[model samples]
Target chain A: MSEVLTYITEHAVQWGAVILLMLGLYIVMTRGNLIKKVIGLNIFQTAVFLLYISIGYVLDGAAPIVLEGAERYSNPLPHVLILTAIVVSVATTSLALALIVRIQEAYGSIEEDEILEHGET
Target chain B: MERLHVIVLVILLIALAVTLVRLRSLLAIAILTGVYSLIMAVVYTLLDAVDVAFTEAVVGAGITLTLMLAAISLTTRRETKPGKRKGQRIVGAATAIVAGVALIYATTDMPGLGIQDAPIHRHVAPYYIETGPTETGVPNIVTASLASYRGFDTLGEVTVIFTAGISVMALLWRWGKDDR
Candidate 1:
């Protein structure tokens, strides 16, 4: 049972991440709403983040700290990189959202097809 | 206990698939996308990547959702209808088949998950794990790798971020008439 538990604990995150990524892709592909597509993009990026972080985990590992004489520690590099990623993501999202606002102003509607139609006219 | 987690994962995956397949509204799709990110964050926590998970939760879930919603406010809710074309369907199907085949082929020779003796383990990973103690004095292997051995990669990542910001500003900034 413990072995089973271990296996589940280890593999669960990957499976979940894959599912989320697939779902996000589906939204991006199928959704007509520009905003919804952006949301899907966020989902996709999140799935990647989960994948990287999951790779960093070590069972029973201590926090990445250099104590007097520690034997094992959880990897911290993924964490640092992730922190940077968060900032980047925020900046990108805000910029994208701002563009959307401008797009709305230029065209009466936000629908992708409608915008194209408006442009054509 | 392990089976329970696996079951939950399966359920989540199923829900995700259903959402992808059936949803018609673009706005609903975006919200579902945010939920997917949140689920991914949970997956990261389970994997023990606490730091990465925290970042994902914030950037993916919080910030992303807000931005998408703002986009929605600016745009219409409806998605465009697909044009009638049998050729398009055939092309799409063929492309999807090729992608699936490629993915399967790529995975064929891949190492099993978490195998201690995988090539990645033998390569730079071991070097970092072994020398990290003396070189960076950092306990976290991931941190040491990013901040030290792979420090260059981190720098590159930062550069990318800077570029992205500049591009966004350049694209979004408005010209003023007061200047001249």
Candidate 2:
């Protein structure tokens, strides 16, 4: 039992990220709201970031910096990639929102079904 | 870096993600997403990725929330209940669950959390950690790697952001009359 708990503890971050990713998938698949879809995408993106950071963790390691007395550091490559990805995520979110605004302006309704119905006419 | 703390934070992140899915009001979702990202930032810090934590806190929490709220202001504030979407919901849930279980199963092959000599810590990482500061004069290894070693990646990142900016402006800016 204790071993099982330890296993759970060790894998918690990875499994938690998977769950969050699934939730994002569900949201994107089911929600008709475009903004909600974007939020769902954010959740998915954040989960990827979480998984990457978790993978880069080193036991008792210092943050990825050059220090005189530090033994080791967590992998810096993931940190670099994620830093760039996070900024890109914000950019993608803003651009998606901009398109949503245009959709609202053009169709006079943001609901997907309504927009489609208008299109049929 | 108490392991317990990480477990707690991961649980909190899951709870927050679940809450976000349940929310109907876009405004409330926007605010809660900020809170969620802030907590996620704390989790990143505990995992020894300070640069990532800082970026997540700032861009994920601050800038993303602002853009979400701005978009909400321009569009509807509340999500209209999607009509006859029951079949879609069931299919989505099924797919998500199946994929999630598969992903968790795949985790068995992953190195356990925080093993010092994990494969990821080998190869280029050791080279970067050992020689980055001396070569680039940047104390932060992440910065050195991003700005110096992986110059093309940073360049591509800039291009993505620039394209996104121009596209957003083109979509939202009023060029002629009858613009909303």
Candidate 3:
């Protein structure tokens, strides 16, 4: 039991990421609501972020700063990428929401099926 | 390794499954999806992708969710209830299974997680690791990759975003209330 616990502790980050990814995907796939889908998308993206960062992690590594006598360090590339990604995500989401608002103004409801049927008429 | 963390993960999975299975309200689902993103951000932090996690937390859990919610506000939420659709589920399931299989096959040769000797470390990473220290003087490898080696890709992405914005503006201007 102790050994298993140790394993789990050692691999906690990995496990957390996998579980989050699965959850996000499930939400994106199964949820019927548009907002929910967006939420799921966010979740999915977060999982990917986790995956990338987790890859950069090094046990017993120092910060990715070069020093006179420092040994190994964790990679900093993923962090930079993630920052840019965050900005992009924010811009896209805001744009999407604006479009959605226009759509809502033109239509009466926010449900996907109702909008489709309405469009047919 | 505490039992609590494992239990929490299992519970999160189950909640996600139920959200997928039982929910009928699209808005509810979207909101839940945001929750899911927040959880994933936490996971990303655990995975040591601190930058990725930060992005995810802000964009995925925050901005993306807001945008999706706005989109839903403009459209219908629920899918049309099934009346005579039969094979849709089968198709979906088949596709999912196939995708899963493909993914598993792809990962079979993946370098073991966190192994420094992986090809990623040897062939791809070393160049960035070496040049970045003295040349660019930037501590962030990601910055080096984007701004130097893959600068063209970054320019392309920026162009795409610009084009998208312009397109949206054109569409809106052409279809505004005054025109109608």
The numbered model that scores best in lDDT is 2
| Local accuracy of candidate 3 as per-residue lDDT tens digits, B1-180 | 223443365357446745655677767766776776677666555444555666667766776666666566556677545443345445544554565455545544554345556554455555666677677776655566678767886786687668657755653454546654
Q: Name the best candidate (by DockQ).
A: 2
lDDT of 2 by residue, A1-121 (tens): 9989878878888999999999999999999989999999999999999999999999889999877899988999889888998999998999999999999999988888999999999
The alpha-carbon RMSD over the true interface for every model, in angstroms, is: 4.3, 0.8, 4.8
Give the winner by lDDT: 1 or 3. Answer: 1
Off by over 4 Å in 1: A1-30, A46-94, B1-7, B10-14, B24-27, B77-94, B170-180
Residue B8 in candidate 2 has what lDDT? 94
Predicted candidate 1 versus true structure: per-residue lDDT over B1-180, tens digit per residue: 423453475468457756655666667766765776677667666555666667677777777776666566556565556555456446544554565455445444544334445454345554565688688877666666767877887787778778777866776567674642
A1-121 per-residue lDDT for model 1 (tens digits): 9877655555655655565566566556655456656666666666666555655555455545456575555456566667677667777776676777677777866566677888888
State the TM-score, rounded to 2 decimals, of chain A in model 3: 0.80
Give per-residue CA lDDT, model 2, range B6-44, as digits (tens): 889889989989998999999999999999999999999
Off by over 4 Å in 3: A1-56, A62-70, A75-121, B1-21, B77-80, B171-180
Q: What is the C-alpha RMSD of each candidate to the true structure, in Å?
A: 4.8, 1.2, 4.8
How well does chain B match by TM-score in each candidate? 0.80, 0.96, 0.79
What is candidate 3's CA lDDT for residue B82? 44
By summed lDDT, the worst window of 10 consecutive residues in model 1 chain A runs over: A57-66
lDDT of 3 at A60: 52
